[model samples]
Target: MDLLIAWLLTAISLLIIAQLPIGVEIDNFGKALVAAIVFGILNAIVKPVLLVLTIPITILTLGIFLIILNAIIFGLAAALVQGFRLRYGFWSAIFGSVFLSIVNGLLNQVVSR
Candidate 1:
C-alpha cells in the first residue's frame, strides 16, 4: 500500500513538474505515470551504485555531484519514456530533477499526514 501510494504521488509530482515553465514536458498523465515509474526504478537500482562509484568526485564537490547524478538519471528516464521529454535537454533535466524531488517531498509530507 505504501509503495502504491508513493508511485501515485510520484506520478502526480511528474505531472505537476511538467506543467511548470521548467522545460519538462509530458504528453499526458499516462506518460507522467510511466516516467515516474522509470525514474523510480533507476533511482532505486542505479543511483546507489553510481553514488558509490562516484564517491571521490562527490566528496570533491562537497556532495554537489549527487545533484548532477540525479540529472543524469532524470535524462535517462526521459530518454526511456517516449512521451516524456526535456525541452531544453540536459539543463531541463537538471531543473526537472530538482523540481521533481521538491514536489515529491512536499506531496509525500502532505499524504503522510
Candidate 2:
C-alpha cells in the first residue's frame, strides 16, 4: 500500500517535471508511470552499488557527487524507458533529477500528512 502510494507520487512528480522546458520529456501519463517504476527499481538496486563504488569521490566532493550519481541514474532510466527522453544529455539529466527530487519530496510531505 505504501509502495503504491510512493509509485503514484513518483509518477505525478515525473509528469510535473515533464511540463518544464528542461530537456526532459514524457510522452504521456502511462510512460511517466513506467518511468517512475523504472526509476524506483534502479534507485533500489543500482544506486546503492554505484554509491559504494564512488564513496571515495563522494567523500572528496563532500557528498556533492551524489547529484551526478543521481543524474547518471536518471539518464539510465531515460535510456531504458520508452517514451521518456532526456534531450540535452548530462546537464538535462542533472537538472531533471534535481527537480524531480524536489517535487517528489514536496508531494511525499503532503501525502504523509
Candidate 3:
C-alpha cells in the first residue's frame, strides 16, 4: 500500500516535471510503478553502500553531498526504468529529486497523520 502510494506520487511527479520546464515523460502507470520500486530498492540498498563508501566526502561536505547523491540515485533509477524518460541534465535532476522528495514527504505526512 505504501509502495503503491509511492508509485502514484512518482507518477504525479513525472507529470509535473513534464509540465515544468524539465523534459520528463512518464508514459504510463507501469513505468511509474517500475521507477518507484527501482528507486526505493536502490535507495535502500545502493544508497547505504554508497554512503558508507563516501563517508569521508559526506563528512567533508557536511552532508550536503547526500542531496547530490540522492539526485544521482534518482537519475540512475530513471535511467534503469523503461518507458519513463528523464532528461535531467544535472540541475534538472536536482530539481526533480527535490520535487520527488517533497511530494513523497507530503504524501507520507498526509497518510500517516
User: Top TM-score: which candidate number?
Assistant: 2
Q: In candidate 3, which residue pairs get closer than 3 Å at backbone N, Cα or C atoms, i.e. clash?
A: none
TM-score of decoy 3: 0.83
Most lDDT-accurate candidate:
2
lDDT of 1 by residue, 1-113 (tens): 99889999999999999999999999998998898899999999999999999999999999999999999999999999999999999999999999999999999999999
- Candidate 1 is scored at a TM of 0.97
TM-score of 2: 0.98
Worst 10 residues of 3 by lDDT: 10-19
Window of ten residues with lowest summed lDDT in model 1: 28-37
TM-score of each: 0.97, 0.98, 0.83
lDDT per residue as tens, model 2, 83-109: 999989898899999999999999999
Off by over 4 Å in 1: none
Identify the superior model by lDDT, candidate 1 or candidate 2: 2
What CA root-mean-square deviation does each model show from the true structure? 0.7, 0.6, 2.0
Residue 101, candidate 3: alpha-carbon lDDT: 79
Pairs in steric clash, model 1: none
